[model samples]
Target chain A: MKAIITTTGKDKTGILAEITRYISDANCNVEDISQTIMQGNFVMIMMIDLSRSPLGFAEIKEGLDEIASRSELSIHIQRAEIFEQMHHV
Target chain B: MINSKEILETVRMVDAQNLDVRTITMAVSLIDCISDDGKVCAGKVYDKISRYSANLVKVGNDIATEYGIPIVNKRVSVTPVSIVGASSGAFTEIAKALDRAAIENGIDFIGGYSALVQKGLTDAETRFLKTIPETLAATERVCSSVNVASTKAGTNMDAVKMMGEIVLDTARLTADRDSIGCAKFVVFANAVEDNPFMAGAFCGVGEGECTVNVGVSGPGVVEQAIRNIESGDAADLTAVAETVKRTAFKITRAGMLIANEAAKRLGCKFGIIDLSLAPTPTVGDSVAYVLEAMGLESVGCHGTTAALALLNDAVKKGGVMASNHVGGLSGAFIPVSEDLGMISAVERGALSLDKLEAMTCVCSVGLDMIAVPGDTPASVISAIIADECAIGVVNNKTTAVRVVPAIGKGVGDRVDFGGLLGGAPVMKTNAYSAEKFISRGGRIPAPIHSNKN
Candidate 1:
C-alpha cells in the first residue's frame, strides 16, 4: 500500500535522517519528500510505497512514535487512498 | 524528487504573510436525535454530540500540524435546538450538555442553540426563545440565535417583539461585564443554512445529515494586495470585481483544504464553505479598506453601494468556483465596530446606520456591531431589525442584525468591549417611538415569492 507520512514539531537536527532511515529500513520506496518551516514550527510531508513493508499500520505507527518521541516530534500516517480521497475534488 | 526549497518557500510565504486557515468547523445535525421523552431526548442529544465530536479538536490540531497550517478554532453547529425542543424543556439541558461536551472535547464553541421562528413561533420555539437570556448567561462558549423573519416567511412581528425583549434581557443579565452576554447572542432574519459564523449561525434544518462548512476570511491579505494598486487602477467596476474575486479564491482554497482534512480526520461528513471576508480591528483588515480601495473616501459615500455590490458578487463567484460545497451567506461584512476602518469612519462621521443598512443588502450580515443610545427603547430597535428583515425577504437572501443598546450610554460616546468586540463608537439614532407598530404581535405574511410554483 502507498502511504503518506507527515511529521511536525519543534525544529531539530537529524529529524529527516531519522525518519528517512525508518522508511528505508521498512523496505518502503520513497516517492516524494518535502519539508518546510512555518510560524517557527518544522513540518515534513512524505509519500512512500509501503507494499513491501513487513508490518501493518499499527506496528509502523508504534515504531514511528518511538522515533518521534525521541526526536520530540509529532507524526501522522495515512494510506494514499485516504489522502487522495480527502484532497481530490 | 520534490524540491525541498520549493516547499520551504511556500511555507515561508504563508508564515510571513499571515496566511492560514482560520477555522475548521464540524456541522452536525441533531434532527435524528429528537425524541418525545425529554430525558431520553437530552440523553440522546448528548450521546450523539459526544460520539461525533469527541476527537474533533484533537484531529483538527493533528491535521493542522501535519499540513503546516494554523486551524485557529474547532467548532460544531448542531440542528437548531428549538426544532428538537418542540416536545421538551430539554433545550436548557441540551444547551448545558452541548456546552459541556464542547468544553470537554476541547472545542472553542458549540453553536446552533437557536430557533428559526421567522414567520411565526411554535410552542417549543417560543419557549426556547424565552430561555436564551438564561441559557447564554449560564453557559460558556454556547452561542445562540433566533430567526424572526425571512423573505419566504415575511416578518414575524410577534417573534420580533419577543426577540427585542430577549436581547435587552440578555444584555442586562451579563451587564456586569458590560453586557458580554449580548456578545454571544444574535437575532437574525432570513438566516442561512450553511454559515460557519457565530452569534448568528445555526445548522439550518434544510441541510444534509452532516456536512462541513468553511468561513474564509483575509482582510489583511486583500488589503495588502490592493495596497500597491493605484486608486485609479481600481476605478473601473470590472477591475475591482476581478481583484476581489482573485483574492477570495485564494482565501477560500486555504479554508476549504483545512475543513476537508478535519472532516476526514474526524471520520464525519464534510459540508459547505462560507466565503465571507470577515474583518478584524487590526489595521488594513477592514471592509472599509476594500471600499477605499475602490476610490471611496469612506464607507457611506454615494459610490460605496455600487462598490460593495460588485465586491460581494465577485467574492461569491470566486468562492463558488473554488468549492462545490460553497453555501452560507458568502459576502463581505460591514460591522461598524468590528472593523477598525469602520470605527474610524463612524468616529469621523463618514459612516451612518442608514448607509450600513443599504450596504447590508449586498453583504452577509446587516447592522452588525452597531451601538445606539442605551435609552433608545426596545421598540425602536425592533423596528430597525424589521426594516432590515424586510430587505432580506424582498431580496431573497440571508440578513441579520446584531445591535447593542449600551445601557446608560448616549450618543457620541464610546464603549470598548475589548478584544474581538473591538471598540465601538456610540452613534446617534432618531429619537422616534415605534411602540405602537411593534406591540401588534402577529406574523408578517410570507413574501410574494413564497406563492410561486
Candidate 2:
C-alpha cells in the first residue's frame, strides 16, 4: 500500500530532515515530494511506499508523535486512495 | 501526482468538519432460512446473519484505518421478517435471536425486522404487525420499519391505521425510556429496498443473495465549501448548487472506496452507494446548518423548500457519477432530533411541523425524529401518514414518518435518546382532529402518471 504524509504548520528549521528521518527509519521509500510556504505557513506532502516498511502504520504514527507535538504541526498519514479518488473523480 | 493543497484540505475536512461514511451495511437475505417451524426459522436466521456478516465490523475498521476516514457505523439489513415468518406466527420470537446475532458479530444495529403491506395485509401479515411492540421492546439492537404506501399500489389506509396504533403501543411499551422504542420504528411510503441506513434499510426479495452497500454523510463539509465563499443573492443559487454537487462527489467517492474495499475483502457483492447528507447531533454536522450556510436566515422560512430542492437535485447529480451504482433514498435526510441545527430551529419556533411537512416534499424523509405531545391521538398519527404518503405517491418519491409520541411529555418538552438517535425538542403540532377521516379506513388510489422530468 502507498500512503501520503501531509505536514502543515508554521515553518522552522530542519523540518524536512526531521520528517524524512522518521520515514527512512521506518524502511519506507519516498517516491515524490512537494513542499511550499503559503503566507508564512509551511506545507509539505510526501508520497511513500509502505508495502515493505519495517514499522506498521500505527507504530510509525506513534514514532512521529514527539516531533509533531514539539513542532506544533498537524501531521497526518493516510492511504493515498482518499486523495486519488476525491481529486481525480 | 496528487497535490498537497487537496491533501491538507481533505485532512482538515475530517479533522474539523465531520465527514464520515455513515454506514457499511451487509444485506443478507434470509429467504433460505425460512422454515414452517418457528424455532427452526429463528435458528436459521441467527446462523445466516452471524456466518455471513462475521467480518463486517473488522472490515469496516480496517477500511477506516487504511483510508483515514471515519466509518461511523457497521450494520446489517436482512430480508423483511414478516414475509419470512408468515406461516410460522413466530415473528416476535425471532427478535431476541437476531439481537444475539448482532451482538455476537459486533454490529451496531440490525434492520429489516419489517413488513411491506402497501396494497393489503394477509392474516399472517396482520398478526406479524401486532408483534412489533414486543419485538422492539424485547430486542436491544434491532430496528423496525413498515411500508404502508407505494405509488403503484396506492396507500394502504388500513395498514396505516394499524401502524399508527402500533407506533403508540411501541411508545407506551417503552415509556420508561422516553418512548425510545418508537425511535427505532419508522413508517414509510414508497420505501426502497437496499437502503443502508438504519431504522429503514431492508434487503428486498429482488436483491441478490448477499450484497454490501454504503451510506455517505458530509453536511459539514458542504457547509465549509459554501462558507468558503460569499453567499450572494438568488443569482448565486446556481453557484451554491455547483458547490454542493462538487462536495457530494468527493463524499460519495470516499464512501465507494470503502464499500468496494470491504466487499473485495469479504468476497461479497458490491451494492449501491447511498449518497445522503445525513446529520447527527453534532453542532456543525447538520443539514439545517448547510441551509443556513446558503444564506437562509432560518431553515423553515419562505425560501426553504426552494433551497432544499436545489440541494437534493445537486446531490444526486454529483453523486451519480462518482459511484458505479446508486440506490436507497439518495438525498438529504432532515431528521429533527438527530440534528442540532434542526433541534434549535424547532426550539426557537423558526421551524414547525407544518413547515417540515412542506420541506419533506423536496427532501428524503418526512416528519423524522420529531417529538409530539403525549396526548396526540392515534388517528392524528395516521392522518399525518396519509398526507405524507400522498406526496410520495403523487411525486413518485420516497417519504416517511418517524415521529415519537413522548408519553407524559407535551409540547415544549424534550425526549433524549442520547448517542446517534440524539434528543428531540417537542414541537407544536396541529390540534385539529382527523379521527373521522382515519376511521374511514380505505385505500387511496394511485396518482396519475407523469412523464420523466
- The B-chain TM-score of model 1 reads 0.93
Q: What would you estimate as the lDDT of candidate 1?
A: 0.77
**Model 1, A74: alpha-carbon shift in Å?**
20
Model 2 steric clash pairs: none
TM-score, B chain, candidate 2?
0.98
Give per-residue CA lDDT, model 2, range B272-347, as digits (tens).
9999999999978999999988888988888998888999999998899788798998889999999999988898
TM-scores for the candidates: 0.82, 0.96
True contacts kept of each: 0.00, 0.74
The per-prediction tally of clashing pairs is 7, 0
Docking class of 2: medium
Which one is best on lDDT? 2
lDDT of 2 by residue, A1-89 (tens): 79998888899999999999989988999999999999999889899998899777777766666778988988888899989999884
